[model samples]
Target: MADEQIEVLVVGAGQAGIAMSEHLTAAGVEHLVLERDRVAERWRSWRWDSLVANGPAWHDRFPGMEFTVDPDAFASKEQVADYLAAYAQKFDAPIRTGIEVHSVRKNDGRPGFHVETSTGTIDARYLVSATGAFQKPIIPPVVPADAGLHQIHSSGYHNPQQLPDGNVLIVGAGSSGVQIADELRRSGREVYLAVGPHDRPPRSYRGRDFCWWLGVLGKWDMAAPPVGAEHVTIAVSGAHGGHTVDFRALAADGITLLGRAEGVDGDVMRFADDLRTNIAAGDANYLSMLDEADEYIARNGLDLPEEPDARILGADPACMTDPVRELDLSAAGITSIVWATGFANDYDWLQVDAFDENGKPRHQRGVSSEPGVYFLGLPWLSRRGSSFIWGVWHDAKYLADQIAIQRSYQAYDAPALAAH
Candidate 1:
């Protein structure tokens, strides 16, 4: 392949990258989008066949394209992939699939960037890393390799029939864990879920979907508070037939609820005795949100239909009982262990010296410390919904504006530099 020079190079042809390319095209800037795999490959390969987006199709619209699906219907993973493919086609985005970006670094003593890819090299004046936030699956290092149990991350899970016929133990009570546990239970597999600290908002509240309230209230567009030492990872899901995934419901369905898994000692799995505390925290957050929503309704004097108290929905007598503290995986016939743990951002392939000690890039909004480098599609990049389907346009537009400004400056300064 011949070395090519472009005005801008955007990496990762996912939602964020496509958005950025669209913006750049509108700005009349020449840019190329590099993709390691096919468009929406992560959505196609990483998700289970039964997985649906956690939000309604109406709430997932991107710029220039509104969802045509039923407003309240959650789109399956396949539908989402198809939607993205159609989006790319509608925009005529200059996306090169199957070209892997191996490194992005400043061209030494040059005024541009050297972007190394599997195909060849490309020199560009600006670079944007549009890789989605969750690039790496985070499995616990404490998992013993020789534990004699079939282990898989949620990304690797497809269906229960693929697993050996036996009970299953799922660690991490986040959205993935809850949804997967529900699916496994429906498949007649005895399942045990490890509870974690999470936010449990009702799927529907006050005659509207919870996400509808969030959107109407401008919570997604609102700026987040200053970063603290620890960021809270809220776990909520819309996979339960458009209802919240409730732990009490799982317990009522004969699926055992365990405290947070502490560690594994041979076949014995120990749990933190904090199941009740975690439940209380989630309930408190849910009630707090409800209170805020009620205040908004009253302040506006809007006559929305009154709904029943949400506290009654997840009420189950068995949930309040002390959860099991330990379990023998071998003795319980638990042949498979599903780790629904969260993901990590991978920047090891990047050869730039722009990241901090924690491996996160030092950036304000999407602008990186490096002069011509930027980032997109990261969680909390600008707001709480920055990583969502509806939030990326703002960041992409901002970056495109900046790129346009730089291009104009370079054009103006070219003659001056040549004179020197």
Candidate 2:
């Protein structure tokens, strides 16, 4: 027999899971939210000390909840965690912290799920996997383990003081990589950032924040990127009171820009000769966004202020002029390497066959192909902003409605089954 029984079980206590809990409560669903650690543990522990919410407070918060800070301000990691905790408290969410979910499998003999956790077993009629998309940090094995260098994934990095007193090599120029690189460079460390495919949206466009423009233009509703396009990480940052991530600006500020880190040979790091190409790609994305915003303003006849300077493209950075194809790490005094490569969804504990060949959950929005199973808090799960805080709230509401529908159907079917 299971240790506990629940109508619904949410397997996370972060923003996604908490958001799910809020909706489940409103829908009159008897659900319990399980968290391995404190609520928003990732924000509290995994993220760097200087990290801030990428989006402004007004746009990043859940519905009916206002952040204590200014709407235009970006909340710090600690603040975000506190906000989530307070939000959960306000709703009186049924969340069990420090209760880790071990494994989840369909109940063959029963029409439900058997969830094994650190506490015990929980048989739940419905399961919502709200553990989030970034479950495991993915650090590629490009460098040998015996390289004798202190290597850490982005999630493990806290601040410059945590590393050895030497230069830093940050691989993968996504938001985290660039932000950390910038922070290190500003801290008097020689920072080398490996450039990769990324989108460079301006911090603000024509007196409006980039997120505001996206909302007004309905870009957030985009279901998916164009077909045949490579996955490009967003290169925006809200650190240091927010600013546009200009590679040229970063380069001019003494941070060295290199092509993608391809591999490592004995004490040497090889890089692709595509620094300029990558920079150009990011620039193209930046200009494209501005162009679309401009056209939208023109077509709609809105009185939004125009900033012609936003369209001006700057010259290439000096570092890009003579890109380094290889770097002798030892000679360069590079004592640490921060790999901001990305993350992968770890669903090993999910025994349900709800994933595709690519290991992605097969779902229509949050509803899975397997009955009573759902996924939440994944990028582009239902829309472009599906993983954002506000987006997750909406998605959670939909899932709650679907769960309600399932419960109603079960109620209608139970009596018929009893008759037989």
Candidate 3:
């Protein structure tokens, strides 16, 4: 590997990296972006072909780059990927694709870091890990081993037709699981979804999108729940055009709600008897979100129509009252399982001690304890929207500001070094 040195190095060419590159370019930071794959590779290959972005295209646009298409419309994965590629090109981001980073460590007693990549090694005074939050797919350790059933994570899911025909068990009630289950059910497959605590928001509330209300309520800017706090997973989808994925709606569509998957014994899967509690928790969070929005409207005194009773909007139907406690995979005719649990951060190559007990990179507002090392595109890094496509720019801009300040200091100290 050829050795070189640079002022700054940004990893990953996704939205976070590109956004950071934009600010760095404007500041003349002299940084290079190293990407393991082509720009937006995750959007292109990691996601399902039929999947669409969760939020509206208008809200998904980055700084100075607007979606020229219908703003209100949901963009498919392909569209989103193409948009990122164009954004990188438009900004002329100094990116080198197909460069897999192996490790990053502090250069002993030096003022920079040693970044080892597939192509070469580079030393950078400032290092930004914009590898994003969803770096690794998490599968439960309790998942049946050698169960003879086809198992795939939601990230690997593409279309309903791809799976073998039979009953499908979706092990998660988050947005991805709910959307995939709905699609499978609509395609004439018997779907059994394992319920989990989540937040259920209507696709459109009153006369505006739920996301717009979230922004208005300042929820996007709000910090994440305290560590280990009981946080509700936000569940919504924009597939086949945006719509709220309600538990009652799924039940009404003949999708069976199974409780949390506890374990697997032989061919039977054990589950908890907590579907009711899960549904109730989700409903409560949904109402709470709406209440927060209403409070915001009242406090702001914006002229708008009176909102309908939230009760009527969030009421649960009798059909969803029952929950399945167990599933005999063979008896139930289940042939496949899709785990939509979530993703974990993959920092195996980061040879730094700046990690929390949970193996997450340790950082405060994108700034790590390691001098000149920073992180971007992490969930709730600075605010609630910090991980989303529309939200990462905020953290990126913040890091850019910090980097610029450091650059100025380095420049100021350069003359002293020469004199010495």
Candidate 4:
């Protein structure tokens, strides 16, 4: 709130930013967090009605804090939003919501960074880009131009029952797409799941969450799941819902699985001629990820599933979602198309030159390549699964230590570095 005298400036007050801010608070460091909307507003408003976190409640805990909510009761999007708010309140973290930061640039000669926002300009020694990857929606370019084909991106999808009475084709086999497909099928709307590389699982793997296996192993840790450098998890998207309709179980329940959509011509959603191949590829990817998870478990000292939990439930090695149709636009009575495809990480609004060949900031951790700039909360920053709230806790601590070490104390104010 002071005039150009803030000690630390944090951008994007989401989970990563909050985690970083909490450390600053414990250190008695004065700082400010800028967010475009209310904290966790996107999570609160964007999720679909039937959405429930895939992982157990224990998975959502913050650093230095336990998620005391029901461990077995998976939280809906709304509940998770409230929990984040409560976490912020618990630490009395200083955040200014509804304030969008436009750009971040280094101050010419100062030992600090500069940021321009809707409110005003801020100068601080460190900047953390906690703006996550799920902020923007990605829609396929070749979708049908039919005025009748109703489609919505998963981000805006609130409730499936709100859609009309007709056959629904949920594209993409990611958690959102598959989950919506199952929900629509159960509600009696003929559902078609246009499958892609999906992460499918057994119905009930040995009475424990299949995810428990990964956690038991170190796959979710630094240097785990990634095939390249340290495994940095992009985003922990969703859990394999054991409570509701499992995607694997839905295959037997008569929900149709189709090949990837070739393109939609009017109401006739055309699919690639080779539906079986697409299904096989998707299934194979899921199996491989499982194998990688299992390999990590065996390497670690975790106890193995004695009775073979993975195979307890039968799997349809041949399961696939099929038949893309070229629908008649006006005749089909469809209004829109929901692109449950996924999200892309965008940083055009961020006025900096810190991105690498992948358009991502090159950082040792959250500390950016630039002198006084840093980033946090981008999935898989340093190791596998580091993007999740559960993972961010560890990363935030490491990054805070990085920031603290970078801030060397001096006897007097040198007009270069400010210590409070």
lDDT on C-alpha atoms for all candidate structures: 0.83, 0.91, 0.84, 0.66
Per-residue lDDT of model 2, residues 92-198, tens digit only? 99999998888999998889999999989999999999989889999899988789889999999999999999999999888899999999999999999999888
Q: Candidate 4 on 1-420: residue-level lDDT in tens?
A: 324657778777777778888888887778888888889777777788767776767665674665555775567777777778888888899999999888776677566667778878777767777887677798888764444456678788777667766767677766677777766767777666666544354323334554565566546765534353232112223434344224456667766666667765544566665556544554554466557656665676557564344433346534333343444434534344567777787887666668888887777766777766777877668676676787787887887777677776522465765767
Ranking of all predicted structures according to lDDT, beginning with the best and ending with the worst: 2, 3, 1, 4
By TM-score rank, best first, the candidates go 2, 1, 3, 4
Pairwise TM-score winner, candidates 1 and 4: 1
| Deviation in Å, model 4, residue 391 alpha carbon | 0.4
Q: List the residue pairs that clash in candidate 2.
A: none
Candidate 2 structure lDDT:
0.91
Candidate 3 lDDT = 0.84
Least lDDT summed over 10 consecutive residues: which range in candidate 4?
A: 228-237
Query: Model 2, stretches more than 4 Å misplaced?
Result: 413-420
The candidate, 1 or 3, that scores higher on lDDT is: 3
Q: What tens digits encode model 3's per-residue C-alpha lDDT throughout 1-420?
A: 239988889999999999999989988779999999999899998887778888898887786887766888988888988998898899799999999999998888768888888977888888899999788998897666588899999999988988998989999988889889998999999999988777788777666788898787777888876454334577899977798777877887888888889999888798998888888877777788777767777788877676585457434555346555667899999999999989888999988878888887878899997779999998889998886887898789999999888777777743455655
Best prediction by lDDT: 2
Model 1 lowest lDDT segment of ten:
225-234
lDDT of 4 at 372: 61
